[model samples]
Target chain A: MPMTTAEKILAAHCGRDEVRPGEIVMADLDLALANDITAPLAIEEFRRSGAVKVRDPRRIVFVCDHFTPNKDIRSAEQVRLIRDFSREQGIENFFDVGEMGIEHALLPEKGLVLPGDLVIGADSHTCTYGALGAFATGVGSTDLAGAMLSGRAWFKVPVSMLFNYRGRPGEWTGGKDFILHTIGRIGVSGALYAAMEFAGPAIHALSMDDRFSMANMSIEAGAKTGIFPVDEKVEEYVRGRSGRRGRSFPADEGAEYAARFDFDVSGLEPQVALPSLPSNVRPVGEVKGVRVDQVVIGSCTNGRLEDLRAAARVLQGRKVARGVRVIIFPATQRIYLEAMREGLLEIFIEAGAAVSTPTCGPCLGGHMGILAEGERAVATTNRNFVGRMGHPRSEVYLAGPYVAAASAVAGEIIHPARVAGGDRPGEEN
Target chain B: MKIQGRAWKFGDDVDTDAIIAARYLNPTDPAELGACLMEDIRPGFACEDVRGGIIVAGANFGCGSSREHAPVAIRGAGVRAVVAESFARIFFRNAFNTGLPIFESADAAKGIVEGDEIEIDASEGLIRNLSRNETYRSQPVPPFMRELIASGGLLSYMMKNLNQEGKKK
Candidate 1:
């Protein structure tokens, strides 16, 4: 039987020749992950289950990204518990402060997740690994515990949805804009419980960084996960990262899909998901002039090296507008070092943006750059949910790095062409 | 199994963040987590105030994030069950794994008004709005899921089957 990429991956993990959507199966995991905030709860569950040893210590990882640097005593206690648990269980992949990046970024960079792998995490953005053609999805902490104890987790095999993205992308627009536009069109529940297979000439052509950005937001569209068909870009990215030769699964031609949608990006504009919901999006032209109190340029979604370059390109010589607080996170320490080597860090600091150690800070409103009540921010972070960055009334606008940095200079949401020097993009200044 | 409660209304896409904000996640205690349920979007509407209430919402309830805290907070707040037009996938799983009852019935979500008395049966997939003298059908909860709920959650379920070998050794 023909199967989609997700179905093929799930079937292989479950030791079945074929699996269909809605057939519940306990699938083996290539990697099971949790961060500081979630691992503590999962650890409690693991202990309560009378599981003395993890099924495979090396296969389970705990990344201390969420409130590390230990924002508060409570957060410190949580990390301390996980650290103790990791040592007790002989877990080898635990990462702590200075040695850690965001879990979603750190795992892929270390090649901990690979194509055709089945990964689960306590974090929603776990689906970010689908960029590598893996079958990965997020679950609650107890589900993380189940994977820890047995090396397997249950899944309701989801049907697939194919999104055909074609045409050249507009300037200052990339994967973030593509995904934001998609969410706006489909609403937050667009894909519901379906695997969103992103395939098309244009999707396959996107850089790995852009692909990561797109896959990272799969949850915002309520997708089981967003995946790109493995191509040369994926093979090249994985070649030097992991020594393991992971299996690859390709959807058979004419494999079933629940639905298919086509998008034309030739004239697509940079998109900004407005306050409170990622689905509430508009082109940069439609929502310009919304002044921001702060600007954030980093997260699991848009804090990669290329995202930094895009932000630095916009902030190269221009200063961040006075009275506007700008903060930049480099996604990972390795990415931070690479940004420094490329002098992107200098451009960011020279523009008056506060550079911080990589953490999920302010993305979940954890710490580092929280907004005051009534304040508004333009963030490259994936979410813009209510009270996501501190005060309930404070607002966050979700955008790609280019628009985020451009808005930082303009002190209001505006097109990148407005700051990309002399009247570029053919927009009247 | 059946649950009855007053109905609390919410619009579409009630994300995990709205169910329980990140600020409240620092403390994992169910009681502490539940105190502030839905605090971000509707401040001062304490979850404690809606004890035993059925949250009836538009489509896509419990969207965003895989934070189990969302469902944990819901059960902690004493919410009996949730009847929505639909639920985001992970949230649906989390709700069941945590033994929190949830139903998907668009008619119940739309027909049941705020503070209306409502009841739901997991085994039967029926939702009754006593205030309006009307009933609606929800998607049936699978047998395996009902088993998880019956055992008080996945943790208890895992104990019986997962650790038996280790215990024997």
Candidate 2:
């Protein structure tokens, strides 16, 4: 039987040759992850399950990215809870402060999850791995706990949607613009209970980092996951990280799809999602003059090394505007080191932006650079929900790295094209 | 299961952040989590006559983040059930896992007004507005998942299944 990539991956993991959408299958997981905030509750359920030992210690992973380095007393306790459970269980992948990066980014970077794998996590952005051709989705804490005991979890296979990208994006527009435009076209719940498959030449043209950004925000579109089919680019990335590239599951020819969309992104402009909703998207030209108090350039969505390079390109020879506070967070410690070595960190610091140690700070209002009440920010992070970054009255505008960096320099939401890229050189960060 | 409560109405795409802000996610006590329920969206929402209430919201309720905190806070606040036109994926599963009954019915979501006395018969998928004298039916939980809800999600199943496997080993 013909199957979509997601369906085929799930089917293979379940020891079946074929599976259909909406059919429940119990599939083995290549990996399962939980962060500090989620692990504590999952641990509680793990103990309540009356199981003293996990099904596979090697497969269970814990990362202390949220509230890492001990944000507060309770946050400290949350990490300690997971740390102790991991130690006792002999789980090999417990990532503490110095070793910790955002779990989704860290996992792919370390080659812990490979192509065509089936993965799950207690956090929603687990769908980020789908960028690498893996089948992944978020599960509740209880489901995580159940998977810990059984090494398997039930899944209701999702119908797949094919989003065929036909043309390349314009300058200053990339995968982030594509996804923001998609969400704007389709509401927040547009892909609810569906797998989003991106293909065609334009999708292949995107860098792996760009693909990661697109897949990371799939949850914002209400998708179970978003995936790009494996190709030479995928093989190259996996081969660079690990000798073994695992396996690849490509959708069969004439595979079934619930719906299909063709997006020609070559003419697309830089997009920004306005305050309070990721779906409230408009061209950068639409809301150009709205002044912002802060600018954040980081998160699992766009916090890769390439994101830093993009921001650095826009920040070179341009100082951050007088009153705007700019903060940049590299997604992982390795990315931090790479940025430091490449002078990206120096450029940001010279530009008046604080380059913090890798953490998810300020993105989920966890810490580091929270916005005050009545404040507005332009951020490269994923969601812009009301009060997401800080005070309920504070606002966040979601944009790509180029636009966010340009906004920092302009002190307002503006197109990168509107601001000269460091034409006047002197003390430009 | 029959749950009786007054209706609390909300608009569409009511995200998890609006349901419970990230700042209030800590300290894991149910009551503590409930204390600031929807405080971002409506100040003093927890202070309202919300106990024993059913939440009726427009389409795409619980649209962002798979934070189980969203449903936990609502269930902890003593909200009996949620009736929505539709729901985002993870929150729907989180609701069942946490034993917080949620239903999908465009009719119930649109017709039920705020503060209306409502009763939900979940097994039969019936939602009736006592104050408005109207009735609506929600899509029933899938057959296999019904067994999950009956066990209050994973508490019984995981506990029993793992324990039995332990003894066998």
Candidate 3:
């Protein structure tokens, strides 16, 4: 039987030869994750289940990424609870402040998540690991507790949608632009309850960081999971990191799909999701010169080492515009250290940007770089919904790192191509 | 099961962030979270005389963030159920897991207005607007889901099943 990549992964995990869409199965998870915000409640539920210990402590990870460094006393208490529970449970993968990065980026960097793994996280962006050829989906803390207690969780196999893209990205157009354009074309709920299988030559050309950015925002499209096929790029990345070949699972050629979309991004311009909805996308040219008070260049969506280098190329030897506050957060400590060693941090700091420790701070309005009432910001982070960043009246414009860096220099949203003499837009400098 | 309540209408893409803002996430206590429910979008909706009401919303309701706090707040605020044109996937699952009933019916969402009296027969998947004198239907709750709700949420359901299995052993 022909099976989609998601179906194949589920089937393998469930000990079945094949599984059909909408069929319920009990899937063994390779990893389950929860952050400070979700872990407290999950721990409560896990204890309420009358379970003395996690089914497999090694398979569960607890990270204090959200509200890390303790936003306040309450958040500190929450982290303390997670720390205590993880210590008592002997969970080996617990990440504290210094060791913590955004769980999504940190997991892959540490080789904790491998290709074809089935992962469930309490955070919505857990699907970001799909970039590595994993079948990962977000669930509530209750579901996370269940996975912890039993090492298994129920799943309804989602039908598949094929997104085939052609053409290489143009100047200032990278993964963020491609994903925003795709989301714009397919509204917010376009792929509801469906597995979005991205393929075609364009996808094959994307680097691991680019693939992670593209897969990160699948939740914004209401997808059950967004996955890329494991190929040479993935194999190379896995080998470079772990000195071991990564597993690969390609979809059967004749697998059925609910819908198929052909996208040509070679000529696509830089994209920006306007205020209120990620689907309300417009070409950067149309919204260029829209004044922005702040610029943020980081998140699980685009906060890889490569993303920082992209921003650094634009900011090097240039100052951020007066009165525009530029903030840069490397997604994880590892990425932060890499950026420092590569002098990207120096470029950012020399350009009048404030650099902070790796935390999800200010992305979800947790802290640091939050917008004031009626303020507007251009951010590399995903999601531009009303009140997403801070005050209900503030607005966020979603763009790529190049655009974010350029906008910071110009004090308004602008295309990176317009930034005088930057290295190739998406290339590491 | 039959439930009747006054309606509270909301617009499309009423996300989890709006339903329960992140600032108030300190306390996991349902009542504390419920106090600020929709406070950003509908200030005082939770604390006001809106108890035992039904939330009627447009498409893609509860979109954004996988926080169970949204449904927990709604259930804590005494909302009997939510009827919307559609729902985000994680929100749909979280609602059922928390025993917060939700139904998707485009006609019902379109016909209902704030303060209108509404009645729901969840098992039979029927919705009736008493003020508008209109009736709408939604996909019936699956038997397993109904059982989860009847057992007062997933934790309780799991506990009951675990206990039954132990007794059988």
Candidate 4:
């Protein structure tokens, strides 16, 4: 039978000839991940299960990113519990504070997740690896415990939704804009329990970073996972990072999709999700001039090197507006060092933006760059749910780095194209 | 498989963050987490009103974030069962894994009002609204899932199976 990429991967992992949507299967995992917040509970469950050892210590990864560098005494205690458990279990993939990055970003860079792999994490953004063609999804900590004890997790095969995009994106428009637009069209619950597959010409043209950003936000639309078919770009990225040829499972011609959406991106504009829900999206042009007190340009969604470079291009030779706090965070230490070596760090610092270490940080309201009460922020993060970044009264507008950087300079939300040719601070006079 | 309680009402899209804020996620103890359940939106819900009640909510209850804390907090706060128009997928799985019973009944969601006395026969998937004297039907809980809940959750279920296998060996 013809199958989508997700179905192909799940069938292979479950040792079945074929699996269809809605079929429950227990599949072996290629990778299992947990971070500070989820790991403590998973560890407690593992101990209670009387599992003397994890199924495969090498396949499990423990990353301490969220609340790391411990926000408070309780956070400190949580991290300690994870560290101790990793050591006791002799888990080879444990990443401590200095070595840690956001798990989604770090796992791919470390070559831990490969195309056609079945992965699960306690973090919702585990679906991010679907950018590389992996069948990945999030589960609760007890499920993680089951995966740890048995190296297997259960899944209900999800019906597939195909999104076909044609035409190239306009300047200042990238993955974040594309995803926000998609979410706006399909409300938050539109794709409930379905795998979303990106296809067609425009998807083939997107860089891996763009694909990652797009796939990372699939959960915001309540998708089971978002995936892009493996192509030359994914092959090139995987080969460069792992020194191994990338593998791909293409959807069979005429494979049935539960639903299909077609988009033409030729005239796409930058998009910003309004406060309280990721589905509340508007074009930057429509919402321009809305004042903001903070601008944040980083998260698992948009904190890659390419995202920083885009922000740097916008912030170059400009200063952040007075009374607006601009903050930048690289997704990982590797990306941070690359930005530093490329002078992107200097550009941000000279522009008066504070660059912080690669933690989930303000994106999750964990620490750093938290918004004050009633403050408004334009951010490159994923969700804009109430109190997502500190005070419940504070508002967050989700945008790409281009919009975030431009908004930081203007002290309000503005499209980057509107400021692209404007005078720089020193050149104005 | 049977529960009787007063109904506390909520609207649609009550996300996991609203059910339990991230600020109180530091502790893993269910009781500690329970104390803060719905504190952000309902303020005193956990302490004053969450005792042995049924949550009757509109569509897409427990949306956003795959935090098991949402179900654990609900179960810990003495919520008997959650009857909603629908449930987000992850939360549905987490609820069963934590031994928290949940039912989906659009009719019950629309017909039941706040503080109405309600009884649920999960095995039969029937909800009786004592206040209105009306009965609503939902998808019956599958036998396997009822077994998991009867064992007090997935962990206990797995342990029981393990012990039975040991006896057979």
DockQ of every candidate structure: 0.77, 0.74, 0.63, 0.58
| Residues A1-429, model 4: lDDT tens digits | 899988988998999989999877878888899998888888888888777788788889999888877899999998889888888888988888778888899999888888888999998888899999988898888888888887788788999999999997777889888899999999888888899999999988888999999999888888889988888777767775664444688899888899999999887888999988999999888894589999999888999999999999999999999999999989889999999999999999999999998888788787888888899999999988888888878899999999899999989998787677542222132
What tens-digit string does per-residue lDDT give for candidate 1 at A1-429? 799999999999999999999888878899999998889889988888777888899899999998989999999999999999999889989999988998898999999999999999999999999999998899999999988888888899998999999999866789999999999999889899989999888898799999999999988889988887888889988998987876779899889999999999987889999988999999888995699999999899999999999999999999999989999999899999999999999999999999999999899998999999999999999999889998988999999999999999999998898888533553453
> Candidate 4: where are CA atoms >4 Å away?
A240-246, A422-429, B142-144, B150-152, B157-169
What is candidate 2's lDDT per residue for A165-224, written digit by digit as tens? 977677688889999999999878889999999899999999999999999999998999
Structure candidate 4, residue pairs in collision: none
Worst 10 residues of 2 chain A by lDDT: A420-429
Interface RMSD of each: 1.2, 1.4, 1.5, 1.5
Q: Which regions of candidate 1 fall more than 4 Å away from where they truly are?
A: A426-429, B163-169
| Model 3: per-residue Cα lDDT over A182-247, one tens digit each | 999998899988889999999998889999999999999999899998988887777656534456
Of the true contacts between chains A and B, what fraction does model 4 have? 0.37
- Please provide TM-scores, in order, for all candidate models, with all chains considered together: 0.97, 0.97, 0.96, 0.96
Clashing pairs in 3: none
Comparing 1 with 4 on TM-score, the higher-scoring candidate is 1
Deviation in Å, model 3, residue A295 alpha carbon: 0.7
Q: Per-residue alpha-carbon lDDT of model 3 for B1-169, expressed as tens digits?
A: 8999999999998888899987777679988888888987776788657788999999999988889888999988888899999999899989988778899999998999899999998778999999989999997666667777788767766666656967999
